[model samples]
Target: MTRKSTGIPGLDSMLQNGFAFPSAILVAGEPGTGKTTLAVQSLFHGAREGEKGLYITAISEPQWLVQKFLSSFSFYDQQLVEKGMVNFIDLGPSIAKNPSDMLEIIKKKIEQYQPERIAIDPITPMTDLLQWRGETREFMHELFAFLKAFNSLVIITAEMSYDDIAHSQESYMVDGVIVLSYPEEEKVRRKFLEVLKMRGTKHTTGRQLIDITDEGLAVQAGLR
Candidate 1:
C-alpha cells in the first residue's frame, strides 16, 4: 500500500512513515487544540509536493476570515492557492435547510478537482446538523466510500468538547483516529496527541506532548 506522510514531523514517525494513502482519518479535538492547523498544514504539505489539495469547510466563516486565521502560521502557503494547487470550498451559507446537501457538494468537488489530498475542517457542524435526523451514519459511510474511491488522503476534523471524544461515532468509523487534547496538569494546560486506532498499521499507542507554533504542530520527541 502506498503511504502519504502527514509532514507533521514526529507524527509521521509515529505512524511509521505516515498515514496510508487513500485512507480517511478523523482528527478529533476540543476548541483551540490546533485541529484546523494540523489539517491545513497537511494540505499545504501535499500541495508543495505538486499534489492537488482541497480544503472543504462547513463553518460559516468567510473565505478571507479563514485565510486570515491560517496566515498566522509560517506553514501557510499563499502561492499554492494562487497557483490553483490548493483550493478551499465553503459549504456554510448554501445549505442551511438540509445537511445532506453537504454530501452532494463534497462529491462534486472531489469529482471536479480530483485532489490527491483533502481536508474537511471541523465536521462538527455537519454532525450536529444530522443529529436526530438519522442521516449521519449514512452520510459518513457514503462520504468515506467516496473519498476512498477518489483515491485521496483525506482528513476530517471534528470539534470535540472534553467528553465528546468518548461519545462521538466519527472516531469509530474512520480508518485512523488522531485525538488532540489539552489536559490540566499541575496547574498547567498541556497539549497532547493520541493515535487511538489506525487500521493495518502499527502506531504509537500513548499520548505525547504536541506543540503548535508558527511552524505548525510537532509532537515532542521526548514523549516518543
Candidate 2:
C-alpha cells in the first residue's frame, strides 16, 4: 500500500514512513494541542510534493484570521496557495446556517477538486449539527465511504482528548486515531502525541514528545 507523508518532522518515521494511502485519520486533541498546525502542515507538505491539497475549515474564526495566523508558520507558503497547489475554504458559515448541508458540501468539494490530500479541521462542529446518534453514524459512514472511494488521504481534526476517544463514534469510523495532549511534568508543560491505533501499519505507540515551532508541528522521539 502507498503511504502519504504527514510532513511534520519525525512523524512519518514513526508512522512507518507515512500513513497508508486512502486512509482517514482522526486527529483528536484539546485546544492549543497543535491539531490545526498538524493538519495545515500536512496539507502544505503534500502541496510542496506536487499533490493537490484542500483544507476545509469548520472553525468559528474567519478564514482570513486563520490564514493570518498560518502565515507566521515557516511551513506556510503563500506561493502554494496562489499556485492552486493548496486551497483553503471555510464551511463554517454555511454549516451554521444549514447544518444538514455539511456533508453534501464536503462531498461536492471533494468531487470537484479531486485533491490527493484533504484536511477537515475541527469536525466536531459538523457533528454538533446532528441531533440524533443514528444520523451522526450515517453521516460518518457515508463520508468515509466517499473519501475512500476517491483514494484520498484525509485528516479530520476534532476537539477531543484521550478520554473522549473511546466514546466518540468517529474514533471507530476512521482508519487511525492520533491524540495530541499537553502533559504536565512538575512545573513544565510538555506536548506529546500518541498513536492509539492505525490500521494496516505498524506505528509507534505511546506518547512521544512533540514541538510546535515556527516551522510547524515536529514529532520527537522518546515516550516514557
Candidate 3:
C-alpha cells in the first residue's frame, strides 16, 4: 500500500513512513492540543510537495481570521494559499441550516477542489448536530464509506478525550485513530500523540512526545 506522508517530523516514523493513502484518519484530542495546527501543517507540507489541500472548517471562522492566527506559525505559507495550492472553506452555515446535507455538501466541495489532502477541522459539531437529530449513524456510515472513494487522504479532527475515544462513533468509523493528550507528568502537563489504531500499518505502540512550536507539531520521541 502506498503511504501518504503525515508531514510531522517523526510521525511518519510512527506510521512506518506515513499514513495509507485514501484513508480516513481521526485526530482526536482535547482543547488546545494543537489539532488545527497539526492538520494545517500537514496541508502546507502537501502544498509544498505539489499536492493541493483543502481545509474545511466547521466553526465558520472567517478565512482571513483563520489565516491571521495561523500566520504565527512558521509552517503556514501565505504564498501557497495565494497560489491556490491550499484552500480553506467553512461548513458551519450548511450544518446549521441543513445538517442532513452536510455529507452531500462536503462531497461537492471535494469534487470542486479535487484536493489530494483534505482536512475537516473539528468534526465534533457536525456529529453533535447529527446525533441530536438522530442521524449520526447514517451520516457516519456514509461519511466513512465516501472517504475511500477517492485517491486522496482525509484527515478529520475531533474534540475528544482519551476515554471518549474508546466509545466514540467517529473513532470506529475511520481507518486510523491518533489520540493527542495532555497528561500530567512530573508535576506538569505534557503533550503526547499515540496511534491507538492504524489499519495495515505497524505504527508505534505508545504515546510519543510532541511539541507545538512556531514551525508546527514536532514529534519529540517514541514510547517512554
lDDT of each: 0.87, 0.89, 0.90
Q: lDDT of candidate 2 vs native?
A: 0.89
* Model 1 Cα lDDT, one tens digit per residue, 1-224: 78988979799999989989889999988889989999999999999888899999888888999899898898888888999888998988875677878889889988998899999988889877887798888988888778777888989999886477666778777899899999899999989999989999999898899998889999988667
lDDT of 3 at 122: 88
Residue clash pairs of candidate 2: none
What is the model-wide C-alpha lDDT for candidate 3?
A: 0.90
Q: Model 3, residue 19: what's the lDDT?
A: 85
When 1 and 2 are scored with lDDT, the better candidate is 2
- How far does residue 167 in candidate 2 sit from its true spot (Å)? 2.0
**Which candidate leads in lDDT?**
3
Question: In model 1, which range of ten residues has the least summed lDDT?
Answer: 161-170
- Model 1 pairs whose backbones collide: none
30-67 in candidate 2: lDDT tens per residue? 99999999999999999999999999988778778999
Candidate 3 similarity to native, TM-score: 0.96
By lDDT: ranked, best first: 3, 2, 1
